[model samples]
Target chain A: MGLPKKGPTLLKKKKMEDDEEEIADLSPEVSDSEPESEPELESESELEDEDLKLAEPSKNAIYNTDGIIDKLGDISFPDNVGWIHRLSVDIDQEQEVDVNDDLARELAFYNQALEGTRKAFEKLQAMGLPFLRPSDYYAEMVKTDSHMEKVKGRLLAEKRRIEEAEERKKTREAKKLAKEVQAQKAKERAKQKKEGIESVKKWRKQRQQSGFAKDDDGGKEMDFSFEDGKAFERSGKKRPGVMPGDRSGGKMRQGGGKGKSQKKREFRNSKFGFGGRKGLKKQSTAEATNDFRDFKKGNVSGNKKRKR
Target chain B: MGKKRKHSETVASAPAKKDAPERPQRTILGWKDKNNTNNNEAQVTESTVGFKNKEKDNKVESKESKGATLNELVELKSCSSCLFFECRKQKDLYLWMAKCPNGPSVKFLVNAVHTMEELKLTGNHLQGSRPILTFSSNFDKNAHWKLLKEMITQIFGVPKEHRKSKPYHDHVFVFSIVDDHIWFRNYQISVPHNESIKIARGGLENSTLIEVGPRFCLNPIKIFGGSFGGPTLYENPFYISPNQIRAIEKKKKAGKYAKKVKAKTRRKVHELSNPLEPDEFADMWKE
Candidate 1:
């Protein structure tokens, strides 16, 4: 009856042991310095302080001991612990203003909130009232479209222009290169001629031997010098070919018998027998000179008679 | 549930789009021949923007003069068809095309010939026909613009010795990129030379020359570098071919059918409610 219950006491001891481990884990300095005893000849009682300063093994041994030493370890938070450890649970607060207190004002908080809310709602309504009409939208779209087209057109024009410029530069560079090549060739030719080298001579001879100078009909020989390429030359004059009257000189069928003059000749021959051309021009001075003319007249009359 | 919600949203959006008017599109524009040779001779501002505005104003006035009808004689207005310079595609996505009004088309023989190319390029051909130089953008780089200017100078720039009191003597070209398309314009520098007042380079003295060109624009789709006619390199999808122009014309014609649509006429009568009068009060006493 004089001592506490066994379970609660054991529980308190276990809790103390746990707390000891926890405290040691949290801060080893607190537990480790306890044993050092470097205080000013220590202020607290030596017995309790010595118990705290003991090493883990010694402390466990003391815990196993059955007496006042075992009871030396006290729990930090016991189940039946009183609030005596804390100074106070709550502050001594005083009311600053009464709940029923009222003050005279033009508008209350609720009324002011409602008025502000109504004003905001009215503003929103006013803002929302002016909606987009179909016509306005269409006009905007058209305007935007026109602007974009202008931009696109401008861009396209610019791109084309740039590309064209680059091409022109390339052509210019090519021309410069060609001029250099030509100048170098001329220089080399002049040097070889001075040295009496046969290469240029041989090349010229070879070109002559290819029947270029005398035979001007060879189309390839016209550009043999490559000198004309330096400047633009007008295309050769394209003279019109001889007319039909001029082509009648050839005796044999006039080059493809399907010509108009040939066709007329055949028609006259069929009508006036063998001397068709002579008969038309000579005007038939002697009317009955040939039996063919009479036969032709008879043939025409006979055919007409048969049809009638 | 998610699928159903998405399907419903799509359906709702489809109807809304159908109800809204369609956007305009861009189409081929006919090259307008400016005959205001006198006004073009007037001294223009040094800035390009001002020059362009002056040119546009002239075109607008010309359009207004021609498009006026009996009913529309009160005020001059620019029709949608006549406003060809404005971009239609960027805003409403409607494509319109006008056939080139010129009859004789100048066709270029696009063959690869080193000698011919050199002759055409190097030879200072002073023939009156305005030369058209087309190049593909696939090979275009930073040097392209400078090259174009050089070519224009080589082809059309008048010599310093030949400078007279004429309005225009030296012509140059400026090339720039707009979107993926390319545009080029020809401009001539004029020097007013008076015999009485002599200056450097003939009688050319205190006078400014305006830029003038019968502008021509063409879109190139491909480029070739071979000696006789080579192969193509990069191809972009932004090319709108001449065939597309024809197709657009056909579709526009089909869509522009004139139906004799009879609009419903309505007539409202006040038979449902009688009109009140002072005589009714007098009649009420008798009743």
Candidate 2:
């Protein structure tokens, strides 16, 4: 049982047989100046991941290249065998792939499969072999009909989820645009009212300069306070800090940030008043009960008390 | 979920093969697990058998990790090759691929197993079609890899004219080596074909593949010269057993309390050795 010493390993070691027996107590220090030594050194220095290889190939690890090649020769088919029998294709990997990156690794495998299939198909075509299954061909499939149905259901569910999300996004955008439009309309209304008030004032000044022409109603000028901005200003007495057209008045409807219909309903309710019991407010308070001035004044006369 | 019905149906289909032994009879063996409620082992074995079309099953229960007994079983069956799935502690799955009589077997730690029953892998193909074997270019870079590739081609590739095999090719198998682990993938090739005899002119170009999966990644641990035990051809230098990894993790978690206690004691000792100086400001504040 003699092994051939043909490679560069022969220059480094005296006998191949001795190298096999010297498997015990072997370390990285034993193998020096080989092509793989530098990389192994780096691995030794770095912290290894769970799946990553050791910093260096173990010194005792056997190569047995000759034995492997011999076995390969013994087991492999004769050269004369047709490609149809083996039905295998080897495709070149373009670059080194990072295993940790799942997408990239899967993509690399997919590319290899795709390329190999393409090549195999071309060869099959050249050989005039019927490789592709026809559309009508039906037989027992690897997966059951029920299993495929489940797969279809899952795919449809995912699509539905995405579509629902898109619909929500579209509605949100439309709502935002509608709000901007409403604000613009309100601003334009205010501007138009201001212009109308200015035009009336100018007309009155011109009439005064022309020497007032008396009308039948004692030459009185019509007051324009209501037409001016003064009429739109919020009254301080009724509800302090309330905007004129704000039906909620920034209090009752605190966080009901709803659409235009909500505001309309609120305004209608404020104008007509909400329908409920008004009897709770009729009861007198303790302060009213203890008031002596109103009691004495009320006792003086019924007409005077009613007037007060 | 019709799981029981599906199992019975698959079992009924198993005995459908009655063909001449033109191809090498590759046998699969596994230990029986009584507590396995999901019957995960049975499903995995059956699905693999179903995928390959006609694989003979010979259940052998052995605790030894060596392939010596497996080699004997292979020779007894007159099988040329074998795939022995050895499940340990009902957790780890170690796959052994061996040439029957003479030598060269590989031990792989199987991870990321997704069986065909999983609904995510949607594609389906003819049950008995011979898959086209495709290998990445790196398989030829080393001597051990080349040998493993030969074994895989023989074991996984259904014979040319086996009676159980379908007439047309409609699926492919991918054996790729990434990060020193061989990953296996199966895909169904779908082409838009209208004719019975011929594919449309650009059908090959238009054809797309859908994954018909039982995805697995195999990390090779050792290559033995004989079928199960012999002179070591190669050993993965970086390979660490899952048990060791688990033990390391447990130790790390277990050490946390001890570490906290040790730090407390050390702080106390330091405080005793060097007491804080009594400052004049203490008297001023007290007064």
Candidate 3:
């Protein structure tokens, strides 16, 4: 190609072509070949710009770290498998310390702190807090370890309280069950006592019904003694203590003997020639009156038959 | 003793005639004392005697006052003016009897009457028993078409222009003599199964005596004024087929012969088949 000699325009066109070539060669390796002093100068200005941006956010964010941590601790980890895996990945990426031993140790510490924080956060959430971000969480964690310690303490206290309540409930149920068993035993004892009384009365009645007079007297005596014996048995006392004739002047006195004056008095009361003879006088008088009426009627009828 | 007391109390409360002379007094009293103490037994005896007496009276009166039987009355009244009066006894009660000089007497019952006067017009006698008048091939052949047309026009009150343009033809006309009363099976020309249109038209053209097949026939005793226990006007099963009759007869004979051959083959095949046991066949067929 031949060069046209219009100097200023030609020089302008030549500079444009050279600038295009410089732009085309703007790769990182090519940039490295440039003077070290120039890059250092450019990087200083870029760093200044980045620092200015960082400082503005850090000033505002650093102050809100406690609040953010409190809020983040409130975020619940879902029990689902997918959510747990996602949470693990998220924590791993954010922490950025990747040596196995170091990661494991950090994970343990973080989990402990996270658990404490989560409990505190849940408490706070239950008290009604708003939405929080992950960055806010880490900032709060960095700001204070005391918050996590407080949460741990509260959890321990709650666990003890729940155990105590459960123990109390169990004891109360045991006592109520024992009372019911005792009442049932008492009812069974009462029923057995009633059955004993019925059998005694039946034995006494059968003894009196047959036509043996001497046997009847003996049976009444036996029945009185038997009833006393049963009463003693039911009371769990010795049988000899309940003898019917043990007391004097009682219905059946012991030894079959009476003092002279007592005998005379007994004789006067026995006018019908039987023991307790006075008790039958009224019954005998009624029978005598009935016999007299029948005799009078027979006499009149016999007189009329003689006349006929 | 308790039962005897109850019996005595019941007898004392019951109405009784002690001195009635119809029976031996001692025996009657003994019988009454034994059984009729209860009111229920007395009432049952009285009712039974009354019922028997009433039944005897009815029988005697029925014998004394003999009148025409219901069937006879129906026959007499229907046969009075009918052209087919000679066949009146064979016809069912209350059926309109039409006679053709050359053919069998056709008895059709009219269950209801629909007239031009009732419809408030003139020029028709749609006053037939059936809502839709089903004509036998004979009636369709012998009936005065002009008279039928006039009857339809007068009864239906169809306008002159509509009647003139839409003339009555071979197709059966089903009328709703009472509003929405008439029900017809395959009434339209577009019915897929009706082969009768061609048969009906042929009958109309031929002027020969035509008999309605059983499928086209209605119960004359049911539709017309027939008494209970009277004869039923049964439709003839045999229809006149004109040129097709011989063909139909041939087809029927062929069908009978085919059925006989099929039965014979079935019997021979059954006999020829092996009477092998089930278990033996099972092992023989197993892979």
TM-score of every model versus the real structure: 0.19, 0.72, 0.16
Q: lDDT tens digits, residues B1-287, model 3?
A: 01111112111121334523221111000111122233322222222111110110111112211222322332323211111111112221122222111111223222122211111111111111011122112222212222222222222222111211122211113221111112111111111124334432222121111111001112222111122222222221211112233344456567788999999999889877956466756677567
Residue A239, model 2: lDDT of: 63
Q: B127-233, model 2: which lDDT tens digit per residue?
A: 87888999999999999899989888877777666556787888888999877778888887876544434463454766677778777778888888777777778
Query: TM-score of model 3 relative to the true fold?
Result: 0.16
User: Each model's DockQ?
Assistant: 0.00, 0.32, 0.00
The candidate maximizing DockQ is 2
lDDT per residue (tens digit) for residues A1-308 in model 1: 11101111111122234334433443466445765665531332121110122222122121112221111122012334322111011111122221112221101211222222233223323544211121212221111344445545765776799999999999999999999999999997666445443444655676789756646665554443333442223225443453444535444435455688777878887887775476577675465565464455445565776778
- Give stretches of model 3 more than 4 Å off: A1-148, A211-308, B1-287
Candidate 3: which pairs clash?
Answer: B109-B224, B110-B129, B110-B224, B111-B223, B114-B127, B124-B151, B125-B151
Candidate 3 chain B weakest ten by summed lDDT: B23-32
lDDT of each: 0.28, 0.67, 0.28
Interface RMSDs of the predictions, in order, are: 47.1, 11.5, 56.1
Question: In candidate 1, what are the lDDT values of residues B208-285, reduced to their tens digit?
Answer: 222232222223233222111223222222333333433544654564453212221111134325445556467676
Query: How much of the true contact map at the interface does candidate 1 reproduce, as a fraction?
Result: 0.00
Write one digit per residue (lDDT tens) for candidate 3, span A1-308.
01111112111132333333322332345345434635553332222110011111112211223332332222212233221111111111233222223234223323332332333233334544321221112221111245335544655676799899999999999999999999998987777677667766766576566444558465554554336665345455444634644444333543344578678767776753655555675576766976765555445666776778
